[model samples]
Target: MNNLTARMRHGVIGVLSVALFTLMSSTAATATDELFGGLTSPHEIDLLSHPEIKQDIQTWRTDAGTQVLFVHSPGLPMFDLVLKIDAGSVRDGDTPGLSALTVSMLNEGTKDYNTDEIAELFERHGAKFSTRYEADSVSVSLRSLSAAEHRIPLVELFAEVVGKPALGATQLQRLKGEMLNQLNDDNNWMPFFLKNELYAQLFRGHPYAQPSGGTPEGIAAVTREALHRFHSQTYTPQNMVISLIGDLALEEAKAIAETVSQALPEGPAQPPIASTPEAEPEVLHFERSNAQTDVMLAFPSVTLDDPDYVAMEIASILLGNHPNARLTNELRHKRGLTYGVVATFMPFKAGGSLQIKWDVEPRYNEASQALVSEMLETFLRNGPTQEELDLARQLFRSEALNSISVNALAVRKISAIGFNGRPLDYIQRQQEEAFALTPEAVRLAVNRNLDLKKSVFISVGPEVPQEPLPELLLITQADE
Candidate 1:
């Protein structure tokens, strides 16, 4: 009996030794593989490493004069269709909110489907349909699975909504009421009031000055007939640019393009927007009993098509693109005068504006303004250093690469290019320019674009120093 027990123990010990040896051998193999897995390959594979992946965009025009831009992304079984019309709020000639209201009313109901039914249809197919109205264009976007069963029906529904929206009186009244309510509510928001007022003062009589949301009086005056007229004039094939991306072949893309183009009436293209005139330098003040004051300094800048646009973009980035920007570094980090400060380049089809905005303690409003002016003046005078230029270029390139890595953002980029009448290779060109940009080029662009002396300064808050109000060209009370 003792001998049997000894044999069993020895057997168990032998089994465990074999098992431990196998585990150690497997771990060593794994480590070795991980250390030199790709040594045999010429290069590693990273889908996002190439910035030129989006360079190949196919372009064609339908028989009805609808321009089509298709980017074939077959890896994903999804698709995005965006139709942009050149009729934006700027086209609302006399009426301010007409274009916005008209675009919003598109999905309310069509001749065949009620609003609920329209919503149900899109939801049933797991699709999303939405609209966006900007200064230069209005867009209707539809994202759906690319299966024929799913895509065909969704596209048809989209065509019906855009091509034959029933501008019902009840719906129009409801939308107008909503707009009026929003406008009334916005009055208490000093930022909104100041922005609109500043635009009115800066652009003056230009259409760019007109509020896209429309004033209360303008929204009240918009008639159903006027909506119908605007729709008839703007929602035409000739004025449309259709952008498609995802698991679609060129043939399928062409068919989809026809589905949209053939539904619309072939009408004349929209008229070109006139150039914005030079803005007069002005200081506008709005008084509000708030803890912190909002200040905005705005100046006329270059349009999207301007030669110095890329340079200005680089310059803007260096100035105040983020928390680490020069403006924020000086105003918030160094001085502790304001919590934050930012600068933005608002580019439109006709022209653009460069604006710097900040919020500061009411007591430091004058000091903040002086510091801001000094910083801008210093930047314009000395320009960026070579190290700063290199950093900005790298930052922009990284952002560009990251932005296009997503499918939806890539489609939006393509749509913007088409809407702005930019070359299909515009992004590539910009990337090249950014990489090759120099400090001198950026300085020249800044000098040619931004004019600090002619900028508009707007302050909205309580205790706004009346003593050093930078050459007040206009002053408005908050209650007004």
Candidate 2:
């Protein structure tokens, strides 16, 4: 840490945090009142004529063993494709920013094309191509015309960027300087302060505890060789999932999948991440130079493989966001302690977390915390009411319907599900399971999955925590 103050960033880096980050860019829908503005209700949509929440996913594998999930839509001549690699920040190991920097450097130049040429190629074909870093994976997504003139050239260019990145010392140093500059400028943009603190304390010793993006020391220490090593080991064909959606035939889709998946060298599969364990109950506070305190209550939730996963999803809906939801009603609607409260589940491969977050004035911070904790306890002890259950079901049904009907949303849905290793019917089953949930089942899930005793409470605001700052954090903040 240098003598200059360390100013934490907020939004941009929020998506890159370690485990339970990304939030899937949120396919989850908001409550009815918020979505429809109360002009119409979610339940008003008739279930009898409602679109089925199903996908005709044509699944296959490339010779290199990359899993492909494809859905054909003949309405438009354009297509959306997504590719996932196991090289998220978790693979950074000792070099925290190694994985993120590696992916960011992908298009700075490739073996056959430079950054300017690559941008020109995409612009020429009217293609939208991007890559994002997640806790468990890195996603490279594209949307372009299906015609060979546009698609063929664009797809090949995509392959070049993914498989043949020109990652060397020059690109490494340039990107490092850019990242450090942003960290220096965005002093007040501490969006993930509470989230970073929460994961640091909650996960403690696990790799999941690592901060996404990277600390100053971590970023400066990242060598060009380390980036190449991380990319090669984790970006292999044996460890990727490809999802394609558009007006193309099965064979055409298969061809596209092949070009992207086989672009990388094969072998050296990613090792499975160890599942997150339950953390003991704890209270933590971050002193932010702000008037209102941002609060987050976190608990270890279900894994993708857990039977209670579906139930946990519904329980989240009932607890927060919805107009009549428990936490919102208690904290904001009835008492007016805050403007909005949100509860979210950040799921990893094996296990994940459920976070209830909100903000309140400094004077009311302690009271808001107690009220939220009490409301959570009562909701767990006594499950959602019949009306609340129906509301959450209707909301889920509406979201599910919209997800499959729209091409843009469906590609993301398919990519997320396939990356997590769920069955083709995972979304469909979740909807069906949510509709059939009895209050008892939801209660069981809330109790079985969330432990009030084990939950960690954290806040960021003007007041410093009673405890002294950790020595590592107290040092002079420098851009190592």
- Tell me, by TM-score, which candidate is best: 2
Tell me, what's the RMSD of every candidate? 15.5, 9.5
Q: Write the per-residue lDDT of candidate 2 for residues 103-171, one digit (tens) a residue.
A: 889888987888889899999999988888767888888899999899989999999898888886787
The lDDT of each candidate is 0.79, 0.76
Q: Which candidate is the best by lDDT?
A: 1
TM-score of each: 0.85, 0.85
Which regions of candidate 1 deviate over 4 angstroms? 1-53, 187-191, 464-480
Candidate 2 residue-wise lDDT at 233: 85
1-480: candidate 1 lDDT, tens digit per residue:
233464689899889966864555443343223322322121333322324423568899998888899887665578899998988989988889998899899889998998889999999999999998877889899999999999999999999899899988999999998878777767667667777887887788898898778877778889999999999999999897999988887999999999989888568998899999889999866788888888988899999989888888888788877666788777766666566777777888898988888888787777777878898898888899987777677666666654554456667888888877889888768877777778888888899889887889898888644444223223222212
Error of 1 at 243 (Å): 0.6
lDDT for 36 (candidate 1) = 25
Q: What is the lDDT of residue 121 in candidate 1?
A: 99
